[model samples]
Target: MTSPAEHPSAESPAPVRWGILATGDIAHSFARDLALVDGAVLHAVGSRSLPPARAFAEQYADEKASPVPYGSYAELLADGDVDVVYVATPHGRHTEDVLACFEAGKAVLCEKALTLDAPSARLLVDEARRRGLFFAEAMWMRTNPNIRRLRAMAADGACGTVTHVRADLGFVAPRDKARLWDPALGASALLDVGIYPLTFAYLILGRPVEVRAVATLSDLGVDLAGGATLRFDGGAIASISWTQTGWPDTRASVAGDGGRLELPSPFHHPQSFTYARNWEADEIAEPLIGAGYAHEIIEVGRCLREGLTESPLLPLDETVDILAIMDEIREQVGATTG
Candidate 1:
């Protein structure tokens, strides 16, 4: 746990320069949030083709910052000006993209479900450690102020003898979208949106001793919807459900003998949460911040400034562990990667 001041790289005074690795919707969202941070800059963008990359740069340009556009990801990685690269490529491409960034001597903030499987995640983590390059999954919710507060409260035993945790996230995704149905792209509810609920369970209950799951696969063989029950060593249980075929409640809760915490709908990036002790009135927790992505973006900058190879909040081990859980769930549900 070295402080930023003690780390040698902290001596640098320049703000972090970010290079986005793709021009997808998520990439655009990240660029928008990056604008909200004082010292962070969207310095560059890259895509497989030049037009989309240039178009993204033009679309996201601000008065003070106009990002350089690169025709290919290789060019973006080669840019010396980019201190860190945010890998927004599809799930199947995350491993290659992040590894390339490391090889190019750039730090990384890769999007979540880090890769299609645990083995790929381990390779990335191991490489990051070997290079001492800053790396973290874009689990932005973990950086949310309210989530931080909830974790702190839970750690302090706000919920006495925690026994059960429940979470779910689902939506009716457009079938026409190739990303949602294309087997080549690693499309599945579990890998796509289900990761959120699974992560919520892991955050509240820690790693599970056993994972039991069932899923409904689409005609194309990817999961359309799924559910899992995780049993922990301490006998605590977490039940998580998700779907892409239809919308579910999309709420999350952590309950115990003494109290419970309830996040509002869309708990993954919740604006507020309610806490209740026994029969007492509910206490609502709310914290303000920009489009939610800013927290993780700011976190990447902080870790880079601190000369950290990984975030203390979202360590590489935890990221890999979560992916392993997904791997197991996929195996149990018979959802094979096409």
Candidate 2:
């Protein structure tokens, strides 16, 4: 496992300039949220072609002094002004895309399931460390203010000796979307939505001792959905599920002998969490700062300015560990990450 902290915290005079690596849905969301951060700039955007990149830049023009558009990803990385990059490429391309960012001597905030597999994830982490560049897995859920508080509460014994954890995330994914259903593109339900519930469990209970899983595979051999039961020390367990075929409660809970805290529907980015103690449940609200993506963007800017190679909130080791567990789960269920 890699050590957590790599650099001392400090301040910088200039704001962090951001380059967006792809123009996907999440890319749009990140670009929009960049406007909410105090000292962040949407410096540029890149795509395989010039047209979409141009349109994206024009769309988010007000976010910064109109981000410069590039026809190729290499052009975006080559920009001398781009201090850090937000990689919004597909899972299958994450390893390649993030490596380019590191090679370009730029810090990176890559999308979740950092790579198609754990080993590939380590490659990126190792490369980033070798280059002394800041790197983070863009698991935005880990940075949500309310989610942060919930994790702290669990650590502080709010969920006394947490014995059981439950979380589920699912949606009716469209078959027409190639990225969601294509195996070569790293389309696995476990990588897509399953990771959310899996990470939710890991955040509360450290690493588990064993993970038993079952998956429903698409005709293409990609996982469409799955269920996992992870057993931890002291008989604690986490039950999580994900799907791209049906609707689920999409809620999450951490329960123990003392009490439990439950996140509302769409728990990944829940509006709030409810803490129940002594038979009474109280709702705790922590309003998000602009579509909930701003928090991660804010953390990235702060880490760059502080000269850190890794984020404490979403450590690279933890990201690798989570993907490793998912690897086991994927195998047990006879699915591939493409």
Candidate 3:
């Protein structure tokens, strides 16, 4: 419920320096967003290869900005000028990469599905706290204005206690040995893409008391499609589905005693929501700077600029809780990988 724009520390500090740790697709999106934050500076970029590092740095750097290109992640984290590092690695590499950044005494804003399981998630969080470093899962939806407003409306009884929720996020991923379909790369409908709907339910319903899940595994030995039913203490329930093998509706809707809320397109990057009551319906839209991920990156800048170790909106605890649910869901679906 906290608003970064309203934070009192907004007036007192300079920009937050960033050292990007990957040169992947999401990394580009994040870099573009960071550029929108007035006081945020992109100091450097690092990747496993020299070409990618140089290419990424050139794309985000300005004539005045001195962005170093490092062929190794260690070099990126070693920069004393970098206040925080953004991790955009694969699902399997997240735990190790994030832990390394923490050890280097840099704050981190990692892309989500934080880790493959709960244990790794707990370890990363504990280490961040112990090191007094800011660490947050980039579950960007938590910081989205539309999502924020939706949660507020739900909390204010706009949805009347949120008795039941249904969310589905799925897409047709091209078949390949790459992460999206590769078992070794930790590709699965649930972990790779399903986390959004699962996180959505958690954001609205809190942690569930019981989790029931089922999935259809691909020949690659990874879950290509799945669904889960989560039950909370007070009879509140959530049903979520995800798939990487087929194109799905990819929508999110919450049903309450009085009404329901519907998100039209990218449920996670929601731009609008509709509240319906019998014959009356109203739709509201929320626009963003670019791709909506910009808001989250800007928020990270805000938190660091103010010397805060954790974001009030997307705290590490909520991330841990979301990962715990994912762990359980994975367990029930019998998709176990380290």
Give the winner by TM-score.
2
Candidate 3's TM-score reads: 0.93
State residue 8's C-alpha deviation in candidate 3, in Å: 15
1 or 2, greater by lDDT: 2
Clashing pairs in 2: none
lDDT of 1 at 71: 98
Between candidates 2 and 3, the one scoring higher on lDDT is 2
Candidate 3: count of backbone clashes, pairs at least 3 residues apart or interchain: 0
lDDT of 3 by residue, 1-338 (tens): 11222223557565667888989888998888877767677888999988999988888887546689999998888877777788999878998999888777788889888888778888998988887777888888888889988888888888787899889988888755488777677777787789999988988888899899999877656888899999998999999999987788889988898999988778888888999978889997777667787788788877766768789988788888787888777777777454
| Consecutive 10-residue window with the lowest summed lDDT within model 2 | 1-10
For residues 74-142, write the lDDT of model 1, one tens digit per residue: 999888888888999888889888988888888889998799999999999999888777889999989
Which one is best on lDDT? Answer: 2
Note the clash tally of each candidate: 0, 0, 0
Instruction: Rank the candidate models, highest TM-score first.
Output: 2, 1, 3
